[model samples]
Target: MARTARGFAALALAVALFGSSGCGYNTLVSEREAVESAWGEVQNQLQRRNDLVPNLVETVRGFAAQEENVLREVTEARSRVGGAATPSEAIEASNQLSNALSRLLVVVERYPELRSNQNFLRLQDELAGTENRLGVARKRYNDAVQRYNTTARRFPTNLVARVFGFEARDYFEAPESARGVPQVDFQRRP
Candidate 1:
């Protein structure tokens, strides 16, 4: 009878240890998932911006046929964003593209007809809305990354994170040049 009791105590101890170990692994997995989900939101918002570009370009084209440089910059920036390899790279490229697009919009201010065009106005509104959504998405992504990184580096969870190959995620940060509204000069050549 005593032998049976000792065996039952040993089993209970093993179960408790196993359960405690699993909690850390579970937390690490949850944190990584949060980061990934937030990244998806950021990507969706970026795609929304990409979808608005063609209409914006067309609207501007009608008013100024000679502004090829600005149009080309927007196109190249779009391509870079499309081809970005990593999440950090994508965020940087997207910000650059947004800055170029902002400069193009400033050029629109020079043409009263373009500014007053209903199509242009509508595209502008849509772009503004997309930018707002992108900002929110970026913030959410950063928050998620922060949480994940903290968990990946914390004591108990860190051990599980290392064992499971869960690494720290980079935050979506805007470049210094893109930290403020882009400066646009529209002075006409004499």
Candidate 2:
């Protein structure tokens, strides 16, 4: 009878251990998935912005072909963003694209007719909306990363994360140059 009782106790201990580990493992998996979903959203928004670029460029080009430097910069920046292999690289390339787009907008301002063009106006509005979406996605992604990183670094769960090779993700940070309020001069030339 004592031997049978000892066997049952061993079984209960084993079950408890397995159940505890399973819970922690599942939580880690859930948090990791949240981070991935957020990252996917950020990428989706970025892609949407990228898809709108060509239309924007074409519309502006029809009205401001002489703005070759700005156009080339925007094109090259877009290419970099498209080919980026990592989050950090993507962020850097995104900043370059943003700066190029800003320059393109400034050039458009110089040509008042471009601003009045129907297609240009439409594309500009679409791009602005896409940019807003990207901002929201980026915020969501950062929030997810913060949660995952914090939980992954905490006690007990960190052990499971380490065992499962779940590493923390990098946050999308805007470049220092792009962090300031954009300057816009509204004075018309005489």
Candidate 3:
């Protein structure tokens, strides 16, 4: 009777431990995966934007070879973005690229002929679409990061996260310069 009672006590302890751990463990795993997947999507959209830059640059070059400084700035920014090692670095580099592209667009407005070119128009359309996609992906990544960080910081799940070495992720925040709406006056002369 004593031996049977001891066995039952041990089994109950094991069951309680397993039951408590299972939910927390699974939540951490899934949240981490969500962050990873979202980051991948952000990278994908950035890559698509990167791929389109050169073609767009070449098209602009044919029309406005004199805008060397603007073109060079865009090219250099693109290179920085491509060479970035981490997410923060990539975000900073991408912001630089965005600024350069904005400058290039302003320069494009100065050349009416370039704006009318079929190739330039097509590339511009594709680039605009890519930028839109990048925005969506960045938002998704930030949302995922928020979710993961929340899970990692929460009481019960945080215990599991700590045991498993899961850390909170940084968010993809917009730069200060990006906070303001860009003044794009298409009707006004550049």
Candidate 4:
């Protein structure tokens, strides 16, 4: 009777330790994967936007050839976006691209012909849709990062996270320049 009781107690202790650790580890892994998958979606949307920008730029250029500075800025921003390798880097690059594009779009308003052209109008609509999709993807990525960070920082899992080196991830956030509406100045040309 005494031997049987001791064996049961030992088994129970092992099960308890394993159960807690296993749950914590598995949850961390699942949440990290969710964040990764979300990041992939963000990258895809960014690529789509990058692909669409040249067409828009070209269309605008045909009508407003003198807006060379604005066009060059957009081209530079798009290039930076393609070069970004990490999430934080990507966020910064994407925000710059957004700002540059916003400026380009604002400039477009100055050219009634560009705005009214069928090709330009269609490209503008597509770019607008792509921006909306990109916004959603960024939201999803941030949500996933929140979940993973929350899980990694929580009790029990925090210990597991440390043990496994599952660090927190950066959320996709817009910079100040990208957050507000682009300022429009009807009085000047730069």
Candidate 5:
């Protein structure tokens, strides 16, 4: 048999073996839901971080008004996160926000009083907690994506996935450029 014909034969065998039990279709449904649920958790954590930003910005602003450029970058990045229409866009925006926030923190290092301020300390603590949660959520989301994508793309399941219009989901990954450690010059003035 030709390669294409053998491939069809395998698919036919897979469907014939699993089709009557409905396991393939049901597994796809369950996995897709798991992925969606994981994605929602990621969004929830992202929102928690988002809600904390303005307070962080304000507290930093009070003591470091001169640091307008870094502050603006953080705000703009947060706005992009809010306005992102897709998972890929949100991932990119969220990465930007992370970078911008890192720059903002570097600015904080320059001012001794800002570091000691109670409000800034509290906000910083809260932001740390939110980042931890966001990290956990992202891990879960990626794990769920792995499971769903595996199921959707696997042998017989691929047939069912195609039949039911279940397409592969995009993973929330940092862009290659963003993956590198950000170069910060401690000597540079904010």
Candidate 6:
């Protein structure tokens, strides 16, 4: 009878251990979901920016026919953003595009006539709003990544994360070239 009781106790302990591990798995899954949702927001904001680019380019082109350099830069940046494969790469490309667009807008400022144009102003306002949204999305994504990474690295959750192959996510950092406001040369020949 003592031997049978000892076997039952061992079985109970095993079940308790399994139950504890299951809780850890649940926490890991929840944290990963949070990260994924945040990433989705980031992607949405990027798509918004991409969608706004063509309209912005056309508006700029309508008033500033001689601004070939600015147009080309914006086009190149847009192409880079479209070709980006990873989240990190997309952020970098987006930053590049933002810088290029900023330079182009500064050029537009020189043409007071262009600035007064209703269509150009509307596109500029929309782009500005999209930039703000993108910034918020990136911050949210970073916060979620931090939470997931912290949970995944914690003692009990670490074991489950390892088992489930959860890896650390990269932060959305602006590109080095876009560290500051891009210099805009608006020197048109007199």
What is the TM-score of each predicted model, taking all chains together? Answer: 0.83, 0.84, 0.86, 0.87, 0.85, 0.81
Candidate 1: TM-score?
0.83
lDDT by residue (1-190, candidate 1, tens digit) is: 9999999999987666556667878887887888889999998989889888878887788788799899888988888888888897898889889778977977887887777788888888899899999999999999989988987888766767787898888888887877686655434421
- How many clashing residue pairs appear in each of the predictions shown? 0, 0, 0, 0, 0, 0
2 or 6, which is superior by lDDT?
2
Q: Return whichever of 1 and 6 wins on TM-score.
A: 1
Kindly provide the TM-score of model 3 when superposed on the true structure, using C-alpha atoms.
Answer: 0.86
Pick the winner on TM-score between candidates 1 and 4.
4
- lDDT to native, each model: 0.83, 0.84, 0.88, 0.89, 0.88, 0.83
- Top candidate by TM-score: 4
Cα lDDT tens digits, model 5, 40-83, are 99989889999999999999999999999999999999999999
Overlapping backbone residue pairs in candidate 1 total 0
Per-residue lDDT of model 2, residues 84-181, tens digit only: 98888888888899999988877877877777788887888898899999999999999998988887887666777788898988998888878898
**Selected candidate, larger TM-score, 3 vs 6:** 3
Residues 1-190 of candidate 4 have per-residue lDDT tens digits of 9999999999997677657777899999999999999999999999999999999899989989999999999999999999998888889999999989988978987976666699987887898899899999999999999999999998767877998999999988788877677675534444
Query: Model 3, range 97-156, lDDT digits (tens) per residue?
Result: 999999999888887788888999899999999999999999999998898899888877
Worst 10 residues of 2 by lDDT: 181-190
Error of 6 at 113 (Å): 0.7
Error of 6 at 171 (Å): 1.0
* lDDT at position 88, candidate 5: 87
lDDT for residue 115 in candidate 3, whole number 0-100:
84
